[model samples]
Target chain A: MEDLFLKLSAILTGFDDLDPKLGSLYYKELMKASGPPFTALLQTFSSKVLGHAASTGHPASADQPAPAGNPEDLLRENIWNVMDFQILSQAIINLWYTATLKLGNVTWVAPPEAYFDSLLWRAIEAHPPAVSGGYFGYWRYPPEN
Target chain B: MDKNYDVIIIGAGVAGALIADKLAKKWKVLLLEAGEKGRERVELVGSYLTATAQTLGSPYKPVPAPAKNMAPSPDGTNDYYDQPPGTENPMVFKSTYERRVGGSTWHWLGNCPRLLPSDFKSNTLYGFGKDWPITYDDLEPWYCQAEKELGVAGDHEQLNGLFGAHRSQAFPMNRIWPSYSDLKVAEALQGAAQQWSDFNNEPMVLFCTPQARNSVPYDGRPVCTGNSSCVPICPVGAKYDGSVHVNKAVANKATLSEKSIVTRITAAKDGSITGVTFIDWDGREHSVSAKLVVLAANAIESPKLLLLSGLANRSDQVGRNLMDHPQGEGLCVSREPLFPFRGPPTTSGIDKFRDGAFRKDFCAFRMSMGNDGGGRTQSPANVLNQLLKTDFGASLRTKLREKVIRQFRISFLAEMKPLPSNRVTLSSQVDDAMIPRPKLSFNVDDYTMKGFDRIADVMRSILLALGSKPEDLVLPNHSTPFLAAGHIMGTCRMGTDPNDSVVDAECRSHDHKNLFIAGSSVFPTGGTANPTLTIAAISLRMAQSIDNQLKMSQT
Candidate 1:
């Protein structure tokens, strides 16, 4: 189930280079937030990828993304219109981008060590607000892309 | 804590720390803090990273109920402050202050643009706010002294004769080099300057901001590495905070009592300060005596202390004329990719709008270019949240990077006219220390409203000049109109006449000779500047006066 969660996360988040250790923590948190529904969502996500590969006449496992369809459309097809798939996908994105989980108004942040590891800073070509480790006046030049 | 001391300062903020550092050399000084000593830097950084809302004061320690044993933010949900009735929509004081040993300097943006000469005599020149008793010339020398003490870095040539105020010396260190985004905005504004001629014919300059953060290692602290978190927490000690001077004072043999909340300042019938009673960490009340007392407890807390003790309000001006450089932002996506999230939050601003002859009609304002990318709008975070709502996979990555990197913003800090109607008083609700919380009734006047209109008009012109549409400008909430910059000036104003003011030119209480009140509370009128540099200068001047008096008494 955890392996399936990682495979789905890679496809859903669009970043295949995510740290597996970080993925493990996120998987646990997703289940913690939505226990039975999370398990159900994982099963649905796996079958969609596997079934898509079969229908497309491509050899694919749950580990392999289909050559044709995007993750958003695959999820949105039959069962995805419901809010469950949308919320779960958003939660997956939030876990990678902000290292946070929101059930309602309350947002639960991951532990401190996982803070600087967020992909949000990576996407923006900037470090987090207070955690910049670069030397003096380094911002004078454009960030190294 | 000791029962008696040569001097007892009620707050351990920048003003208190500056005074303590000076006075501790000769007189035995005791600095009493309502909040505990500062928490670890990494702890604060971690808290800021984890905070969901990520408000200004969220990084500080709030578990022990923060200051005087209460929750961190006093203005969080209007639970701490008493806003009068009929204030449901129109007026609310949005700024808040932290109460740790370092005071609100912990979360200050560290942008220290000095007040212009016109700021000192606004009433005499513009017929707007009240004139300060002391002139810019009188405070000029002290400003230089303060820059050295605070280790201010600046490009002196850029702001040499800004609005007719002269600098006696070069800054202690060179200015923090402008960020790449700052240069891009500067180039855009140079093109935009010709268009601003219709609004105000004054030449718009993109001047590098003078800041207290070290450009090079001046004091023991390391140089700034563009942490870009100067407001919440400078992960490294590159930025200057009040705790720096507090350490200096303690090293010089001054006493510091943490988790000690001063409740009431006692006085004799003759109106001389006798002593003060405080509640300690264990909820034990203790009274301490001092030959001299300085109130560096910020604008709100200082006035609340005076009102609590029924002292220093002889002019009925203890808690009147509350003011803040209420700020508004104009967020825009630049035509080109100019990466923000660099160098201290802001490194450059326009001094042309800082002062001019237009003050007779509307209040003057300062224009600052934000390098933090839609700061109050919470750029990268808000952008990511919006993207994640529908976008995922490759599209998500592409949208997030494109939107955040090209994102830019320009914010204005406008001067608010002093109004007695906007004031701070004692609330019916009390803190854990049994002291009443501060109540505020704040609203801007027509003069400030007119200034906002001008600000919007000028912003539109600048956008057009940058080849951007006015529609791209994202302003603040019109209902609130402005976000509090936390200047918090006035309330206990200083003037020669005791009839309408709380303190004298020397910050000596008109009602009590031994009592001296420091901090922005003594600012009769704050111009468009951030008020910290001026706060340091005035506190240094007040310390000089007190030092001379104490020396004379010993002789």
Candidate 2:
């Protein structure tokens, strides 16, 4: 179940290096947040999308697009275009990027480690706000990629 | 007799904490707070990490809830005051203060800019707001002292006389290095960028803003690690907060009573403050006697207390002239990748607009360069919200990187002219404490609107100069134009005339000699700078006067 959810997150977030530890946390959180539909999202994504990407030996990358920037365009037309699947997919993607969930109409935040492990921070080459473990005055220079 | 306190401070905020620390060794001072005990740094950092709203007061929600008997101070999420009937811009007061032992500094961004000398003389120079009874020179030494007490990090060489504001002593530590985006913006605003606005042809200089966060370990605090969430909580105890002095005062044998809310100050028939009656967290009433009483409960609450007690309103100036620095922002994409969301929210700002002959027309404004890209605009959400609109997988990641790397923003904080009408009065409405809540009557005048127009112009010039196309510039929002700076000043102001002001230059009530008030409530006319450092300086000076007065009485 964890493996399948992570695979879906990787394909959706476009970041192949999603933290497995955080992946488990995000999976549980997204499952609870979106309910039974989240289970269907994983099953549909795995059967329809993950199988093709796994066989290809590489997930979708900007270097190569599938259809309309997605390969075979199967992912967008079948899943991304479908409102129900798209909603779950977008929530999964947002959870991986920000580690925030809106449950019970209140912002349910992830653990501190989850905030630090956010893929969006890695994507932008910046650390999480207020948790910069970087040295004094490091902001004076451009962040090293 | 053994429990008698020489001075009993009303609120344990920055001003109250500093005064308590200064006099704790010499006198038996009692530091009273309307909220709970100060939380641990690590605990607060963890609370902030999980708080969904991530606002100034989010870290305190997990702590004990506010007692029913306590005066109200909440996180900046809901409306705390109501506008009078038929008030035009009833958007409500935007800034919020905390109800914690450390006061509102827990959520402050920690930028500490001193008011320019001209800021004190704006009334005489600009023919606008009233002049301060004291001069910048009188506060210069104290400003220097306050910088040391607050552990300010600043470039003495760059800021010493940028606008003719003198720093007699050097900053305690070197300036915080500007963010990479600051260096980029500084370069972009040079030469041809100066021509972007014919309105003010002067070159804009982007120097590091002086801040209370540490550069090196000082006063037993750790050095700053450039945590981006300085506003909500500094994960490390690098940024100075009121709790530092509150603890120091405690260590020096001064008493601290958290959740002991002072509802009404008891006074003699002679108009002299005798003592104050307070309610503990359990709602039990207690009164403590004091020779001297200090009101340090911020701009709004201090006046509310005075009105509640019916004391020190002989001048009828308890809660008049409420002011806050009306602020707004502009965002765009930079041609060069200026990675943001590091360091403090603001590392550098333009000093040119903070003062000028233009004050004769509109109010002055200070422009801050945001290190947090698309700051309140939420660039990460902006990308994801725009994401899956088209692409998924690798393209989404690539798009986020591309968009976020180039995100940039410039915020403008415009000065507000203090009007007697923009006041805080006691409301018929009562809080859980059964005390009258503060009813606000506030508005933005045309003078401030003109400053907003200039801010729009400056943002246009700078963004255009940075090679950003006109189409890419996300300018100001007209409907919700200005933002609340949280630098609330001028509710019980100080001046020479007893008839026009509540307190004197020493912050002693003109009507009640031994009664003193602290914090930004005493500011006569606010300039474009943040009020914390000035609050520290004035509070320290007021402590000296109180000590001298006590010594004279003993002699």
Candidate 3:
């Protein structure tokens, strides 16, 4: 993954500057590193920006802790998930903005996480307070007022 | 002869609902509701436009109008009537109360507090407001029964004059959990009570006010999620709507006739209520016979129904002594963000001044502060300014959103005593059905004002103690026409005698052997606390009385 990021970084940063042979070599390496389905560029962005917090392993928690289920653990996992998404999503959005400027239109820029983040935040505020204000702001709407 | 129903109950609010549920086991019961069952009303329920209804639009649509133009609404901007006072009668002005199957419960806050012991004998002790025929001791058992029946959740251990009434059972459920704001005010007042020790030293205690609303899973109902929007409907079935009980009664085999707007009570030659005549919304009239009749149509409508039926006119006090708790609103902003929109409507209250040492003229209690954020801004001038300032696009939305929303506010709900002069009467003008509309002529007396001022001072002091700035406080004036507190009580007051009042100790009307009244409308004086608890208590006793009467007639 690290090697793919380095190679993808080289291509995105200075695709015009690379020799034809070097550029083809880097492109082949990107394809191999990313595996099937997702492009090397998408994988690099997701791992660095969106998946970073989940990799850190702070789990999320449940909205309401009931006696029946492992409600407490559920609550914790939910919290981690929410925090992970917010931080990762925002970071990726920021990285995309920078990456897009350097890569130009020659390469695709993934949709910024800020769009999804804003939508989620709006929904959270509109929801009842009890549902949103769980541990670590899981499903927590940003303060509207 | 084929006998009619054992009891004919009117209205389907908490009072009528409970009584109907109890009586349906043996006696055939006829429950009359003016409106359809579970009808959705968008206005009362909040909307997405702001998640609170736009206050503008057609104000009323009662089969008969609500209390004509009693006073302008509490916000104090619009006239209750389309025209000035004399041009249109006040009774037919606008609808203040809900008229659907559950009645106003759909819009009620669901606070079910019991009246203080002193409130029962206000006339005897304070020399104001008529005394209840029954003592606090007499109604204690039934109070417990009512709490159980209504699925009340309260901390009985922290009740006022706890020893005054002996309960056979504990509350059906526990007290409601406090919102962050409820805890804050309660803590502040507890300290203030100690400071004002000279004012009788009851040590202003704060506890969760008992509410018909669920706090935990009870009787198949869900627990309250602290919606804080109890005044309007709870879209989630967590808060207790009176219709829950109405539905229970129907499940228990109680007969319900809806959309049958009752016009009058038809009596036999002996003055026994032979039947009731009602007109449907489609202009079709139908008469149904019953052996016994009950009037639980609330303070405003109950008396109007009686007057229309010509049942309780002998004393001329049928609907005369209408009363409501006069609120003295004191709004104060906090230095720290309280995040007001994140909790229950009210979770805690100060009860130090609920009774003892306070004269009849003065009454006071601390009401729970609400979350100030999230609800829409209805200040017309502010809305008008936005229209004048900007284009009607994204900028306008952004500006309106920023200006209208406030994240913090704490308000005070001071207590008021019921005076004889404050009342509901029939108006001169008739509606489409030819029945005179209900008129409310009420004012908060100087005594109530004094009590409010004193309480307001204390609240301001408490707010300051909690790091609020001097400029943060705003005291709303109640002298100008504003709303009477939604807690309406006392019109068909309960007493010992048929001559002095309408009903007996058990809420049975004196004149008619079979007629009974349920709810706060039978209260002798509107107490400082919410009356839903006491109303539920009276409903239990009423059901028993009706049952006993049925047994005797069978023998």
Candidate 4:
């Protein structure tokens, strides 16, 4: 479960060196926080990707080394193998952006850790405007290039 | 037994808080709010820091009431307001405002432009909408007072006769520095005179807009630091909100009851308001009687309460003539990097079209330049959604950064003439608390739509001048092209005649002598400016009239 979680995290974030321990922690918290639906999606994603890699002798196989190129490229290449994987991919991305899960009409807010670690801050290249991470008038300066 | 007070002001928004702060010095005052008192400033700032979506109402927790403007409920079960089925332009009439302790100012942008002289006499000048009983001159002193109270910062040099608002005093503080985007656009527009002309062919000029936020640390608040978060929450308390005056009112011996949703107002047979009844979150009812009652519960809720109580309806104008600054926005990429999304959301605007002979043909508008650095229009999330469909790896990051920095948006807030047909009425349905929900019927007339078309032409011209191809300009759709400025006004309109208007010059109801109404609800015509400054000025004037009347009764 931990290895699959690490591989999924690497594919989603496009980062190969993502700490396996951090991925395991995020996976455990996501399952505990979001419950059955999120875990079920993960299970399907693992089976489709890993099962295909084993049959086709792809680098994603457990017996072989991981792909050397961008994980996103590898996932994009094999994304069509799973049905509705794009929806699951977007759901995972939404969790990173809003720290929440939207199952149908209902939305469930993720835990505080997920919210604090959302990738939205890094994408915007600025801390939340309401709680300035710097002194007054710090925004007057250009953001770090 | 019901508690008695000298004065009871419904809604603890800016108007109510100001009135309470002023009148509480001599008269016993009670402020009733429908929402919670909200978290402390520090806690609220923290909540804003971690919010995934920094929407206007994100910092404050949702109050468990049927405020239709809040988050709309799914399944169509819980609604804040009820409109007739197939209402024309439902989105245009859909307004958003907070019902918390400080009311909508919790998310106001602090843009403080005074209404021009023609704004008060729109009927006489343009033969459309009713004229205000009071002129800019009558409210000029109060505008100064409101500016001082709100700690307005502005450049006196920018106060040309463009809007015809003469200021007796300079702003309380110096003007906030314009953002990089504002400077870039202003510089570019300076040379393009032929492209930016008004109806009379007068050259349109860009000037720094007067703002209510602090620029030099007046009133114990720090200067605005350009956090670009002025709308949702000002983390450093640089921008003014109703909480400042609410706190002052509390210090001056006014009792504020939060989470107290005012349900109905009682009036005597002699056409005088007697008392008010409110319900708590726990469904407990409380009543308070007062010598005078002021309904400051915004434009929507105040009228809803009147309709529910069946009071102040003699003129039958209690909920008629609803007005809001219907706005249209256009987005484009500047030829040069404007670096938007950096300073306060807006810092400058073009007031050339605020009033003119074009009023005979179409509505007039105030054009404002946005400065939020692409956070609103083209956020990283939106860019990623578009980029991820094609690009991968480092190319994705490169495209996102390049596209975001060049995005710019400009919006026009057009003045809509008050029509008796566009209104707020009580629906047959009721909420769980048995309170009637407000039903709004609104439509954008051809006059306003024509004005949007003209503004679109001007916007395209401006974008072309800023080094954009004509094809790159995005014009608003005329069929459905209005965004609610949240400047709800004219429902409880003030006028000299009692036949057509709901309130008199003093914002006192024509049917009830002691019943005064504050806030933008009493605005006869909301010129193209944002209505908060005018709301504050009129509220201060109303507070003075109430004070004088109370003093004379003792004599």
DockQ-based CAPRI category assigned to the predicted complex of candidate 3: incorrect
Score residue B202 of candidate 2 by CA lDDT: 64
Worst 10 residues of 4 chain A by lDDT: A50-59
lDDT (tens digit, per residue) of candidate 2 on B1-555: 234789999898899999999999899899989887756788888888777776677777636654453556755434456555465335466788987788899888899999999999898998998999999999999999999999999999989886788778899999988998998888887754654243366677887899999999999999998988888888887999999999999999999998788889988988888999988767788989889999999998999899989999988888999999988889888888888887788989988888878889987888899988887865676776687577678888888888888888899888988988888898787777777778887887788887776678878888877777778898774576577889889989999999999999999999999899999999998898899999999999999999999888788
TM-score of chain A of each: 0.78, 0.77, 0.20, 0.62
Off by over 4 Å in 3: A1-145, B1-3, B38-95, B160-168, B186-194, B201-203, B373-417, B477-482
Q: In CAPRI terms, where does candidate 2 land?
A: medium
List, residue by residue over B223-246, the lDDT tens digit for candidate 4: 787776787788778899999999
The local lDDT score (0 to 100) that residue B457 gets in candidate 4 is 85
Tell me each candidate's i-RMS in Å. Answer: 1.4, 1.7, 14.7, 3.5
Error of model 2, residue B143, in angstroms: 0.4
Clashes of each: 1, 7, 20, 5
Best by TM-score: 1
C-alpha local distance difference test of each model: 0.82, 0.83, 0.57, 0.75
**lDDT per residue, candidate 1, B112-218, as tens digits?**
77789989999999898899999999999999998998889999998889879889899999998988988887787776665454336765668899998999997
How far does residue A84 in candidate 2 sit from its true spot (Å)? 0.8
Instruction: Report how far off residue B250 is in candidate 1 (Å).
Output: 0.5
1 versus 4: better DockQ goes to: 1
Chain B TM-score for all candidates, comma-separated: 0.96, 0.96, 0.85, 0.94
- True-vs-predicted CA distance for residue B431, candidate 2, Å: 1.8
Please compute DockQ, using alpha carbons, for every candidate against the native two-chain complex. 0.69, 0.61, 0.03, 0.25
Relative to the unseen true structure, what is the C-alpha lDDT of residue A140 in candidate 3, on a scale of 0 to 100?
Answer: 16
Fraction of native contacts (fnat) of each candidate: 0.84, 0.86, 0.03, 0.21
